[model samples]
Target: MLINLSKLLSGDQETITEQVTLEMEAFVSSIGTFPVVEKRSFPLKVSKIGADKFLIEGETAVTLDIPCDRCLTPVKVEIPLNISREYDKNTVEEEAEDENLIVGYNLDAEQLIYCEILVNWPMKTLCTEACKGICKKCGANLNHSSCTCDTVELDPRMAKIRDIFNNAK
Candidate 1:
């Protein structure tokens, strides 16, 4: 949703409320393939704070199907988003050091909001804290049960150490 800043830029204070859905599949770069992110629909409230300045506030709830790092299993994670931002027509370099910071001027409001969501995504994903990863010996899943192979066969370098222990016994 593109917010028309005509009134706000003209020094007229007004409040604009909007509801829209944004597809964030393309914004996710950290994850190789875009996890299944449901369309985000939320209420956005924008109020003109000053001439060429505005404040944006909104909340969005989204469900994501992410892969676990340990077992590679799909895990459903819900991301509840609440954000507030201020925008000014003057660029950062053009404004004084004490002036309020500005994000986007010519960009659409929805696009800027979507970008914020992408920045808040988590880097690491885990299905559970106790998730037993794949076995190192035979590549079996340790979560289900232990493998029959001897622990010594897993690493050939340990065979000599095992023989020394047997000789000591």
Candidate 2:
């Protein structure tokens, strides 16, 4: 969605409000396609802060299917989005990062949404808080079934410590 900020820049209105839905299936880093189920809607509001500066704020909700960090199971996760960006049509700041400062009369809503998604996404996604995780012995998903493997493998670097304890006994 390309937001034409001409009116807001011209002082035609103090603020402009619009609702938009993003339906693109874009590949995300670490996570697969975002909003694996449906489109995401954003309720955005843009206000004139100065002669050429504007403030944009919005909220969007998105559901994504991501692999659980522990069990590697595909889990449905709902992410809440809250975004705010400052824009200056006249000033171009090279140090300003994306979403923090936008220049020009046209605002790229899709890019803004992508930025919010990245900011809100967690580093790890788990099906449950107490997931058992997969078994390292047989590569079995511990969350689904139990494994009979001894599962007591120790690091080779700690062999000296184990031998010292054994000799003490």
Best by TM-score: 2
- Candidate 1: Cα lDDT at 141: 67
Expressed as tens digits, the lDDT of each residue in 27-61 for candidate 1 is 45444554545656777777887666677788876
lDDT of each: 0.63, 0.74
Which clashing pairs does model 1 show? none
Q: Name the regions of candidate 2 deviating beyond 4 angstroms.
A: 30-35, 88-103, 151-169
| Per-model tally of clashing residue pairs | 0, 0
Residue 112 CA displacement from its true place in model 1, Å? 2.9
Model 2 lDDT per residue over 1-169, tens place: 7777778877788888888777556536554564455456767898999887778899877777777888888788777777787766567465433533344777777767776777788778989999999988798999788987865567787988999999999
Model 1 spans with C-alpha error above 4 angstroms: 89-110, 136-141, 144-158, 161-169
- Compute the lDDT for candidate 2: 0.74
Quote the lDDT for 77 in model 1.
Answer: 68
